[model samples]
Target chain A: MRRALILSLALIPALLSFAIAYLFQRGAIADFVWSGTYQIDAAGLFSRAGLAGSALIAFILLTFWWAEGRAEDTFQAERNMQEETRRRFFRRLDHELKNPLTIIKLGIANMRHTPEISSQQQASLDRIGQQAGRLQKLVEDMRWLSELEAPRLEQAPVSLAEILADAVALARAAYPDRAIDLAVQQAPWPLADISGDRDMLVVVFRNLLDNALKYSTPGDKVAVRAADDGQWAAVEVADTGIGIPDADQPSVFEELYRGSNVQAIAGSGLGLALAWRIIKLHKGSIRLRSRQGQGTVVTVRLKLPAPRD
Target chain B: MSKPTLLVVDDEADLLAELKPLLERSGFAVATAPDGRRALDSLQHLTPDLIILDVLMPHMDGRELLRRLRKAGNWTPVILLTQVGTPAERAMSLQEGADDYLNKPFDPIELIARIEAVLRRTRRGDAPLSSFRRLRSGQLSIDRQTRQAKLDDDAFSLTARAFAVLEHLMLNPGEIVTRQRLLDEVWGWEHAVETRAVDIRISEIRKALSAYQPGCIETIVGTGYRFIHEVVGHA
Candidate 1:
């Protein structure tokens, strides 16, 4: 529609100039015929001029069409090449790291069984194992992100409230001793379910809730609030933890980006990025609002399932 | 009885070196193969109780070997090892007749647990049934097609709610299934059911289950119910 409008707008000047030229040519031709210098018919001259104008206009349009098609072709090719490169890179990373990491982990497990190792050596071994686990998690995160770039969602009717509850349950099970006061509320009880991949939706909320719990210390307050409009559902995951700095807030949803203020916290830094990717895949919007020392609230807005869809 | 022998196939010599002693110490006679071709050659002359197949290899990959094994009527229990195991991969591995699967760089502890669970299951005069359409633990089994819970030779009729609650519990064996989770899962979230309602269905299932196996599902006081058995899944 925009292109058509632009095309019409572009023709206005051409049409005006052609009209002016045609009128001028008609006047000249009439004078020539009256003086009998050229002996040209006015109607014949007008028809010839109109044909030439049409040919010129068609040539210009053809040039524009060719240029647009070439631009799109290169753009598409570049995008596809980039995506293939990413997929190959992740595959190599996964395969290369698996066997050695396995060896390190299994070797650590075996070493601990020996009675000769001192307590200090055991601690170091444990640390090595933890770092290996973190690396494995990072690799998994990268793989999932790459997969998300393609359309891999098993879309279905999924309940946001139920998923929120499940995520809270998982978070609670994972960290039973975080000592954070947690609250969850759903406006008007149960919200209408949205169409999405159940597993992915669960992961998105689970990561959001997990991050909320992970960034907070003991006695911190974390809450989840969700509401349903007529055709959309909005949820807010808020926490009274050390909020992200203004400089880092914008990039928190980028892959592997960690806040400078969160240097002490242990994280893969892909949780929010994963959540952002998922919400975007579901045709939704996610936003983070925070102040330096106060708190952060992440709001997610998603569309409800269409009536006949 | 002699120790069970395991065939561990991978292209990484260093991993095989590290893994062999671990499995040996865990009471298995471990045999190593550098790739799928060697593993298949060994299988022609040797019968290992379990085959640990790696996903990536030089001569052939584990998935192809697995497909060939099943096509040729090799019924030995197989556990797959892979890198960055996704949900789809996990599901596919099980469907391809693998007894179990573990993501690479895993704790040796989980590996052992999976091994034992798989062994115990196959030892129970049962076929490798990770491709489960039915759920079972010992003498009690639930057929999903008929929605019937059978105990030994007797069939106990259960309400749909009870069967769903039981199915969920069986699916997540040894994990706590909270009252709220059961309600949300079984009651469809739209029904405003109390946590007390979960108790009623659990009692009905508990009475029927106790006839064959006592204390099948335990109530964890304040938290939830945990299915107290090594649940085996089958077709």
Candidate 2:
């Protein structure tokens, strides 16, 4: 189709010059005799007319190209402005939530020490404190998503095997009573390291591992496998537990999006979204594959820093 | 013998009201300030044990007050209460001479912990642990040059490599030590692919000391480990 378009574009100018030349030579185009009143200068003027028509066609194409470029620049500028606006909105939200949450938390902490409060009131405060904690975590994740726009990453060479091991350890620590079998498969070969903020990358993998643990039940197997293709290091977190419904897979990375099937499970629905944002900031790509009631597999790919001479 | 005094500075009157009683209950003689100028005014006559400054304020924010206090040669410990931001921003508060910082909406208990940590460092005159010949905390003690360690008056049997790792940890208690740094200092490897050796040594130390104290050495996931106890170093 592109070639056809180019061919037509070329043919339009040629066809016009041909007709112009023909009108000069034969004084008509398909029986229109508009050349009757003018002198039929058939000699030496044909090339000039064709050159003039070609110049006009080139000028029009140039104008269209410039206009398209301008439109794209405008589009890019608008996109950047939108991103900044979103960042500001989140920052303001974080500020608005910060003081009130602190006040509530401190107020509860102070009241807990009051001697007059009964056990039932203590339990109620505990519940309020727990729910307040959940809100705090949601706001924290939102802040992270905003900070990802202009992250200050401290770059250093990092090991993927160690990262997987740590991530698995954290997951196990979080659910010590759960009988899920969590394992980290060491990379067979010495994988090249990637440069990134160690803490930030840990947050990404921890989020992924937490999701794997949170969604699965007892006797389920959650495996973290690390491998490298000599250039890109790929880590896969696979779980043989309840998987995401096919319908919810597409919107998994949307902020505050929780899978409808797993509403009973405790989560902020921002884990995967934060993970995706962090990976994007690290210049890596992540992909997810899952089947409802079967299992889920998430793979993260990162380019290894080039070896120095 | 006397209660530690803390000057709390913030713009939120409700927060100030809420925090004053909590801090007083925590055994601190609390003095409240509406903003930085008043905080400075309190400083003219009152040299509290510590200052808790809020970062975002109407006039003279936490950073400015921190800078001004340091500029006037006042080395009083200050813990900045900042909104959640980048790690680099937190690092900046420290660079501007804040003893510590806590993100806003933090647990009041954690604020107490940070305050104690800052006071501990300042009260000790910020001495390096390596300067002392012996390090002691709780029932754990290590003789620096002799490479001798004891836990609960029992011999802490650790491999020489593990001992080196433990000694390094003792010298910098309550700070996260990266595995690569352990490998560099203890194993003497410039750059090695395997950091699992550091982990193995850490586990060895933990196992040997588990009977006496199980959780002294904490693994800072995905980075390294931290010796979670406060070790006093002296001759």
Candidate 3:
């Protein structure tokens, strides 16, 4: 419908020229007796008018192009501004909501500790505490997402052994019931030292291990191994559990994305997202290999720091 | 067990009302303050075992209150209740003197745990010997007998509170000490107060320690302060 309007507008100049040319042609074609009074050349007049009409068409097209370009820029800028404003708004909203929730959490906790609160109320409070824990994790995930855009990766001489130990400690704390088998070669590998944030790397490993434990069946073994491939260091987390389906592997790293097998799991779908972000920040790559029934292996490769001259 | 004493400071009446009965029933002797000024006024006579302090308040925010408290030799364990906007400040509060810091809208259960932890540290004792015994890292000397800090032969003069913080850090060495722990141990801040009281005192400790030895204390940006220098074994 709008295209028709533009086409009609473009034809106006041509139609006006045609009408004037028809009048000039009528006089020009008159007999010799009327030649002196009607000296107009129809073709010449129409040609001259056509040139002006062409120029008008060109001007119209140029104006259209310029307006469309400006409109696109304005639209994009407006969209960007809207997104930034939305992010800020959500961040503030998260903060505002956190306070009252905290007070409630504190109140519930205090109530639970009291001998006066009934056993049933304590149970209810326990549920509230669990939900609050979930809420806190959600808030943390949001904060992590915001930071992931340009997450700071501090580089310092870090002991890989120390980091792995910490990750193991965290895993033990996270799943005290789960049995984890860890095998280290008789001699500790003199791994290459890399300048990266140890805490972020810890999160990455912890998440990987946590995912392994979450997906694994009882009595299944979760194994962690590390090796140096000369140029990069490779750390693999392998678990004998319900593996990720082939179809869901691609989108696993996407933010807030969870696998089809994750429906029954208790998670915010942020573990891998955070892990991906942390690895990327450290200029590393993470890959997953899994089959529907077979176990899954997640391997992360990070560049080894260059030796100082 | 006697009810633990907790000082709840905030300008919001509704919040105070909500907190009072909740804490009272939980076996706490609760005191209330509407603002930082009133909080300090209350502090003069009532030394709460733990303080639940708001970061943003009228007539002296939590930070200023902590600064004044440290300057006047009032060391208390404080758990800072902070809003999201003040995260950087919240992190800094640990350095100031907060034993532990929790963001606002926190889970009351977690807050209680933090409060109890600080209270446990306080009950352990206020003496440097007890504080020093809780931490271990390098060969750093904190002479509680003379209230002197020495890095080998270098003499460092620290305020009583500053010395307390140093002692606390020396004990932990490489471990993270939240601002709340410092406030609870050094300043005797009873409740979890704002994190800034920690920031100011840490800055003071840093200045004094660095005067004797460069880069003696390392500021762990989002966590509490730690003494970074490796303690060399005495010959």
Candidate 4:
């Protein structure tokens, strides 16, 4: 309908110009044609020129509107194509990379069980195993990121406190040297149950706590606190670590984005991005506050389901 | 008596090969199969005490195999293995009659521990159903044969580990059961330097018990816990 309106509006000026020049100025035009070199009336000539100018302006406006719409359509199609390619590439990468990594890890496990290996050879094997583990983690993260791009969450009733506890246990086990504390201050009468994908939420909390531990030094305290309001449950993961710079805060949740000050830190930089996606899928919000040289605090708020009778 | 047999079915040749020897070294007679079909074939020839089934494989998957086994009235405890499982998958596996599951790249020691726990639970199920004595303290009662516990009107359920802990505490009422002892006896974790798991499970048991009688499990500061039996006919 809009296109039709634009087309008609564009033609109206041209039609009017033709009608005015031909119908009203017929006599002057006829006289000029008969005499071959006739006297020109400035008023009629200027009127005719004005009508032609209006027609040109209308046509230009129509062209601009049409071009803008076309550009947007092309951009959207390109974006969709790119996303599909990326998803497929990652899926293939995950399978190809993980299978080999699993085999290598299994081989390493088998070798470790052998009793005839020398200490030097064992050290080399251990190094290979550690590198293989790192590669496996990287592959897993990439696959996870791809999955998060279009997640179909299997929502269920899950306890926020239980998820927090599990995340803390995982972090502690991963980094045994670090002191991680989980403090649940205000729990609902019977622990608040949030309607969400439990596994995805676990990944969210794990990533947050993992980040807290990754950027911090040994012996640094990483604290996780959870509390429930009447309608929402809030969790905070705070750590005394090399905090993100002010300039880098906005981009922290961007895919593959890393803080400028974290050059020395080993990370794939997909942790926060994946967390943001999973939280968004659950209709939750995550916020990060950091002051360089001080610490970083990540706060997440998730909607709680109504208490069941 | 012959060692209890465990049939491990996995498509990964290298993994199956490595796991067979490791489990054998741990003192279990291990059987192997490449996939679900072969596993079913092996089952016909030998009725293993337990089965470790891999979730993803050619032809028939672990879930299908478990379904078939349960449908056939075979209740041999089966543990499913997955690469990276979600909680929903784990819950579904358990609902489908999987005794337990282990994620890939798990520690061999942890695998052994889980296997032992499952085997023990299954063996208990096969014993004389009601012949075993039920231990009682005040209003609380624990049936060793059924692995069920009751406190007054509230008949609460417990996990295998929690039930084991409760049974041990009730068997030695008034005695201060140390965390180390509980870990060693209930979990069979002899070298578990960290007793945090014991404390966590104890707290869980206490919460469950609180439904009927609060403070039945007393925390002995700086030590472990004591099951303080309530006096009969007391306010």
True-vs-predicted CA distance for residue B126, candidate 4, Å: 3.1
The residue ranges of model 1 lying beyond 4 angstroms of the native Cα positions read A1-88, A148-206, A209-225, A238-250, A260-265, A290-295, A306-309, B67-74, B91-97, B120-125, B131-235
How far out, in Å, is residue A244 in model 3? 3.1
Arrange candidates, best TM-score first.
1, 2, 3, 4
Model 1 over residues B136-155: C-alpha lDDT tens digits?
Answer: 89999988668788887688
Worst 10 residues of 4 chain B by lDDT: B185-194
Note the residue pairs that clash in candidate 4. Answer: none
Per-residue lDDT over A144-188 for candidate 3, one digit per residue giving the tens place of the 0 to 100 score = 555444333446666565666667777887699887766433355
Best by TM-score: 1
Model 4, span A1-309: residue lDDT tens: 999999998678667555545443444433231112444453455356565653454344345556777988999999669767866786677765644665576667778878899999899998998888677666756666565532346466678888788778878888988899888865346447888865567778988998999998986779998887788889999999989999999989876789999988898887898898788778889999999888999999999887677
Shift in Å, residue A275, candidate 1 = 1.1
Cα error of candidate 1 at position A69, Å: 16
Question: Could you give the CAPRI-style class of model 2?
Answer: acceptable
lDDT, model 4, position B212: 69
Model 3 reproduces a share of the real contacts of 0.35
In candidate 2, what are the lDDT values of residues A1-309, reduced to their tens digit? 999999999887666655555554453433222232444334434435575563454345445556778988999999679767877887788789989999999999999999899999999999999888878777777776676653345456667767766666667777886544444334474656787755556678888888888888877878777778877888888888799988999989877789988899888877898788778888899999999888999999988888786
DockQ of each: 0.30, 0.29, 0.21, 0.10
| lDDT against the true structure, each candidate | 0.76, 0.76, 0.68, 0.73
TM-score of chain B of 1: 0.65
